[model samples]
Target: MQTANNCNFRSSALGPAPLPYHPHHPGLPLALPAPVAAAPALPVPVPVAPVAPLAALPTPPPPPPPPATIVQTLTRHVPVPVLVPKPFPVPVEKLVHVDRPVPVEVPVPRPYPVAYPVEKFIKVDRPYPVHVAVPVPRPYPVPVAIRAHYEPLHHHHHRHHYLHHHHDW
Candidate 1:
């Protein structure tokens, strides 16, 4: 009895235990793996020639009828006044020649006055002699054989300049 109680307690802890395996099931159908289907085939294209537009038909000619004729009568009437050329009066002055030639007095025009003779006197201007004191070109003192050499003059000039400058504070 203790063993049966222990089994029952273990079965209750596992929650009613799993159902026993059966040969036939009545609750649900067995699950099947999903079926893979192939893609559908594409339609084949048909080749066709382009159709041309039809040309327009020519127009029918018009029917002909009868020709027409006209008659006219001509009449003439004379004008009362006919245009005649009339004579012109002759000029007595233009036809006859005169004994004394027609006096044409043409007045003689006076000549233009002669220009006055101009007496031009040239006034002589006495030019005051500008006494420009042109500095007489003094020819450089020609060095002679008897003259002293430049060395002495250069020494003398240096000594003079030194003596003059020495006195300045």
Candidate 2:
């Protein structure tokens, strides 16, 4: 069999090219041809017309108040009374008494001994006297030059000292 690219001839030359002939087995074929039957003839139906148009209706008046019954229209009106609660009473307590036997039992305690101690006298000796040495004064020696220098200064200031001492005026 020839591949697609190898077949260069135009298709119109062979009425649709005979469907590329495929190879079949000598003993068995892949698929057998199926048989077909023609369709049955159907009956033609007659056409139907639409229903007639509805009549124009008159607007109905509101229905009369359901014809009032005698028991409902003549009923009476009554107001119920309010109930007031009552106050509760105060409670009182009760007393009870009981009796029993009494017993008298006294306890006796043991006596403890008292203790007395003996005394002894002790003597202390006095300390002996001690002798301490005292320091004696020594006479200081005077320098003649010092006494002479101070004599002149003392005499020069005698008049100032006397004037300060006398303030009678």
Root-mean-square deviation (CA) per prediction: 54.6, 57.5
Where is the poorest 10-residue window by lDDT in model 1? 128-137
- How far in Å is the alpha carbon of 30 misplaced in model 2? 10
Across 1-169, the per-residue lDDT of candidate 2 in tens digits comes to 4458654344574555543333544344446667685686787887889665565555688877863222211121111111112221111111011121111111111110111111111111111110111111122112111000011111211222211132211
Clashing pairs in 2: none
CA-lDDT, candidates in order: 0.24, 0.23
Error of 1 at 35 (Å): 9.4
Worst 10 residues of 2 by lDDT: 144-153
Tens digits of lDDT, candidate 1, 1-169: 2255333233355556434333255233345446987887798888989765454545576767553221121122111111112221222233222232211111111121111112211111212111111111133122211111112111111221111122111
TM-score of 1: 0.11
- Whole-model lDDT, model 1: 0.24
How many clashing residue pairs appear in each of the predictions shown? Answer: 0, 0
Regions more than 4 Å wrong, model 1:
1-37, 54-169
